[model samples]
Target chain A: MREVFQQSLREVQERLVKIAELVEDAIENATSAFGNSDVAIAEKVIDDVEEIEALAAELDLHAIDILARQQPVASDLRLVVGALRMSASLERMADLAQHIAQLARYRYPESAIPKGLTKTFVRMAALDVEMAAKLVELLRTQELDVVAEIRDLDDDLDELHAKVFEKVLSDKLANNPTGVVDATLASRYHERFGDHAVSVAKQMQFFLSGSLD
Target chain B: MREVFQQSLREVQERLVKIAELVEDAIENATSAFGNSDVAIAEKVIDDVEEIEALAAELDLHAIDILARQQPVASDLRLVVGALRMSASLERMADLAQHIAQLARYRYPESAIPKGLTKTFVRMAALDVEMAAKLVELLRTQELDVVAEIRDLDDDLDELHAKVFEKVLSDKLANNPTGVVDATLASRYHERFGDHAVSVAKQMQFFLSGSLD
Candidate 1:
């Protein structure tokens, strides 16, 4: 029974990593699409979102099934619960990325964001992608240190967000009022990107402490 | 052992409701703070986020105990897993609200978003407040139907968002760029509010179905 449960738990974890990869891809695609004003990339992200959502729903079911069938205890229970919680957050991360894609599709051809802030935007996007990837690492290895590490990376994202505000908000708004809306929204998205990083951090904390206890 | 486990599970449920209430208030506080450009109100929200995170951690511990002590299967397992998933999502929702608040605080006083869009902004705020409140109802009652009701209410929010967008984006962007930005972010918050509602709906689905299976 324990072996069956462990196998099921491992399968859930592996599936979660796969889903995380899709989420990472979606955010990167959405970022590139927005920065380049590429509607095609945005549309592709939109098309893939349903599959992501379905995968998330399916994963949650499997976790719940493991918990129900195996009636796991302590660390085992923590593992399944953590997987379920992480999947929900990751699903939202995908939704947020597709949301960014929707914004890109909405603003295409005549880009609302100023061209000058592309560098900052790309940097923010890279941070979001890396956070998603590293979160998967943290989950797979269960290196409790990664809980704190995710927060440190989140702080870096916060710094990036602050840079966008100080460097781009004032600079870009003064030059072009129309672009200011997109600039601010893009900044908001980047900041939100940081919060998702924090979300993963919190999940890792629960996983670590729950298992340890 | 079953009785003792249920006691902690009950405490978890009660605490979950408390956190839900906190998230509800945070959404309202952040929305109006953004609308009024009140940094102090937004600051209060930022301060309270840690409390939300802590509550979530405590809830996880309680649920994990229930799982370990009871070795719950079938219906009990479903309820605990669902509670676990919902609490995690609720925590993220609170964090997101704080993210919005931080955005408000960071850009305060001099947002320059056109003052004319206050009505639209307020409408969005109310929608967020409504959705959060409804989600609380759905969770506490264990009513999938209530979750569906929240989903139905989102239709109204969607219409309002669409109408606001059509007016805000299509018209002369040069005249009220700030208003557009403010309204846009407000709408984003509202949309996220709806997304969280969907999350509650999904959790209810799992909770309701897990028992039946």
Candidate 2:
């Protein structure tokens, strides 16, 4: 029974890594789509989100099945519960990526990065992609250090989020109301993407350290 | 054993309803604060969010404890899992309320509702507060009717969300970049708050119907 529980745990971990990898791809494609006005890639990200959501739902069912059958106790039980949460976070990250891609799709041939804040957005998108990659790594390895790295990346993402606002509200873009709206939503999507990444990291932290603090 | 497990389920239900009531209050206070630029109420909402977070964590721990001790299966098990998801949604609703309140505080002495959009925001806030109230009732009664009501409210909220953007981008607010930024964020916050409420409703639906569909 113990060995069977351990095997189920491994399956949960593998599934989590699978979802994280898809989220990484989604964010990467979505950000690239946003940066270059790549409508095809944006559409691809948009379409792929449904698959991620389906997979997340499948993973959740699997987790619940494990709980009902194996009835894992102590740390084993926590591991299963944590998988449920990580799956939810990863699913949210995928949704945010879709939101970013939608921003690009909405703008069509027109660039979504606005006029003067291209660099800031590029940096923000990079941080998001980098964080998604690190999330994949963390879920695969459970390395505690990766948690700190994800948090630091989130700090950078937040600063860029604030910078996006600063530039949007400044006089330079005063006449560009559409730009202001697009930048606000896009920046928010990116920042939220980073936040969901951090949430996954924190769940991993709880699994590793046995406390969320 | 059966009685103890049933009692534990009751405990879970009570706790969820308790948390929902708190969430309803938070959104109510938050929207009021946003409308009136009442920094005091905004601060109150902000400060109370931590309590909601703490309660959510506590509820999560209690659900896990029940899982470990009772080893419930099937519907009973799903009930506990649903409780966990509901707690998460409620906690998120609290955070959105805090974000709305923070917007109010940030624009203290100045209404966060951009001129001409006051009625729209007020309507949106009303829907959020109403959804939250229905959430509390849904948790307390498990009445599936409330679920449909919540979805309808979310639809209205989404329309208002789009309307906010339309007005913000219109020529009337062309010069008010700050107003655009605030309206965008505040509208998003309120919309998300309604979304979370709908999420909780879905979880309850899952509990009652044995499927999330």
- Which candidate leads in TM-score? 2
Lowest-lDDT window of 10 residues in candidate 1 chain A?
Answer: A168-177
The parts of candidate 2 lying over 4 Å away from their true place are none
lDDT of 1 at B154: 83
Candidate 2: tens digits of C-alpha lDDT, residues A122-171: 99989999999999999899899999999999999999899998888889
Task: State residue A17's C-alpha deviation in candidate 2, in Å.
Answer: 0.3
Candidate 2 structure quality by residue, lDDT tens digits, B1-213 = 889889999999999999999998999999999999899999999999999999999999999999888888877888899998889889999999999999999889999888999999889989998999899899889898889999999999999999998899899888888899999999999888988888889989988888777
lDDT of 1: 0.74
Which CAPRI level is candidate 1?
acceptable
Error of 2 at A114 (Å): 1.5
Clashing pairs in 2: none
Error of 1 at B176 (Å): 5.7
DockQ of 1: 0.42
- Residues B99-186, candidate 1, lDDT per residue (tens digit)? 6787687677765245545676677678778888888787678776776677777887888777666666564544554556656666
